[model samples]
Target: MRVKITKTNLWEVALALKILHFADLHLDTSFARIGFSSTVARFYREQLREALKRILKLAQDEKVDLITCGGDLYEHERYTSDTGKFLQGQFENIERIPVLLVPGNHDPYLPDSLYRRLFWPSNVKIVTNAELMPVWNLGEVTIWAFAHLSPTQREAPLNEFKLSDDEGNIHLLLMHASDMSSVPPGKPVHCPFKPEEIHRAGFQFALLGHYHQGRLSSLQASSVNVQESISAPGYGYPGTPEPLGFDESGHHGVIVLEIGDGKVKAELRPISQFAFVETELDISTATSRDDIKSQLQYWADEARGNYAFARAVLKGQLQPEIELDLTVLREAIGSYFRYFDLQNRTYPAYDFSELAEEKTVRGAFVREMLNRIKLATGEEKETLRSALTLGLQAFEKREILEQV
Candidate 1:
């Protein structure tokens, strides 16, 4: 007997193209700018390599149709031949799935770049063009990509390019461009383009890089939950698969895109083993170094600090008699965390009223500063308080360090 399939059943059986997207692996980074020791730097570099292996394994496990790398796969200046061999082996392991790469500012497509120097797997495709160029046409989907030929690529590849026709197929853009609308503070724009440009280019979605923080555009919400399917034509940044620095503090992962039935859904799969955490610690009631250590320990325990690279900004008033030795504080709780950093922004706790009443030069100075502080408001008040602290430090023969 012959069976007829209903429209709903046909839709259920429709092919869904799954693409696993990630960017900014930045393998072999020295980590020196973040003040990491050589040993720690090497450890982080190894972590990046491991992250790549995990990403490949996830793609295979998910049975993704394609794997896309937005860019900055490694630090061109520091990437060794061994790293290239490692990447080659990892990609070759998933030879059944096609891999697409676009070089970014940090790992541009220079003549000596690994992209050109190494013999990548036959399934891997690297976009070497400095302009928008179609690299793959997978029957139902066409991927357009570009590379940063120089370390300072600033050309906007999307501004002038537009699809001639949709041809009833999904068009995807893969590039390491900066979205001007959501550029991170202190981040330089590279291959800059606006969000509207993605729509103007007539693409279903643009997988992006250059922004360390993952974000989505053209969606009702700015971010998405894991495996929460939503039909939308948008662009997104998968961000770095691992935290490169303290500035990149949120979830670091890969994006899984499923396109079928004329709808596209992106899901974030968090795969990073390490985390970068920043928090503020108020030591207003603390009277000793042990108190600070205890507070840090408590926070570490609460945060599951085993794999955390943490930074605590010490704020609020600190007792005058208790001098904060950052080294001691870090040593006290350093073992509790993988890495710990302390930034002092504390103000000295002073009994202003008592100091003003004393019969001494210091007393007179304190009295004058207190009078000024009372008259001041807003920033002026804070400025006077800082001056008072500095003056007191000078009188006490204590070293005055600039507050961060």
Candidate 2:
């Protein structure tokens, strides 16, 4: 039987549900982009499993009423039978608490999907439909979820989705969707939807996934209004439980949602054991490779280098005769961090004013490149700068091994 809940009588009955929401776990990921060795990659994959274990432990300790995984629980292409068993075992440990999963693009609900091939715990509910389907009705709360039938699902799940007014339960949405308003660069759109569409569909809260940056959107009280309360219904992206790439650098974790006392409160609980750090080092004043190494060491120490997977970009005006060997630098100081990647963005410190006056081919090249750089913008300017550096190296008969 469906029970109706209204704001007028919200306080008359007890209404409390504690939920642990997480997404984008991406277990068994290749970690190829980070350029980690095979051994290191395996270690990171184990870390992801550890993260899931910690999340489950937290849920059991906190006694959450429910647990929702937004999606991308594992990479479908890399998932193995062992991983399937591990997942089943973990979920079974939290057998008392109901667990819901909405599959994302990386782990879609295909015929060969693990969701279909393997038997999950009775308490684990996997959404199998491409459209929004009502999966659970917990008296005062109703959860509607969906799954990505394909890896390239481009349909907007909430386009015309609307719940009937008669269903007075606190409607909630669980899915792997891209919030169109806050998509990062280079991220492909999958199951896109506007934030307003969620509330318009009468859903009190949306537990979302796909984005790797944790975010919570809720109403805020302002001084101008003075009377408005800050506890309006909203949606959130719990992001990835662990840092997947350098682009995902900020706090990555799960969202704890407590619904009671006529209000909903969301809090972020960080559970990532590793950090991805990206920073730039100015090598302008360095005279030798040792000097560059010293600067890198200093930057690493300052940034808490030992605990992070770091990418260092070396940028500055370097002496024309001094060529930086990125491979060598990485070999020298890579041990300082768990993982290290070095990029060279330095330009030759040429006296362009003096070179432009010379009658040599090198001088002519520098002047032309500088003029083009002045007229160019964005990536084009950087391209011209690189060309100039390479041209200078060719004229000097030096080995052009490093990227400028």
| Best candidate, TM-score | 2
TM-scores for every predicted model? 0.83, 0.86
Clashes of each: 0, 0
Across 97-148, the per-residue lDDT of candidate 1 in tens digits comes to 9999999999999999999999999999899887686788774677889889
Q: Model 2: per-residue lDDT, tens digit, 1-404?
A: 12234443433435788889999999999998778889889988999999999999999989999999998999999999999999999999989999998889999999999999989999998999877877887757778898999999999888877766555567788989888876789999998998878877878888889989887776232211211112567777777888988989665888898888656777778888888888898889999878898888888777655668888999888888776788888888788788888889887797878888889887888889989999999999999888888888888898887673
lDDT of 2 at 127: 91
lDDT (0-100) at residue 207 of candidate 1? Answer: 89
Q: Which residue runs of candidate 1 sit more than 4 Å off their true CA positions?
A: 1-15, 219-229, 350-404
List the pairs of residues colliding in candidate 2.
none
Alpha carbon RMSD to native, model 1: 6.7
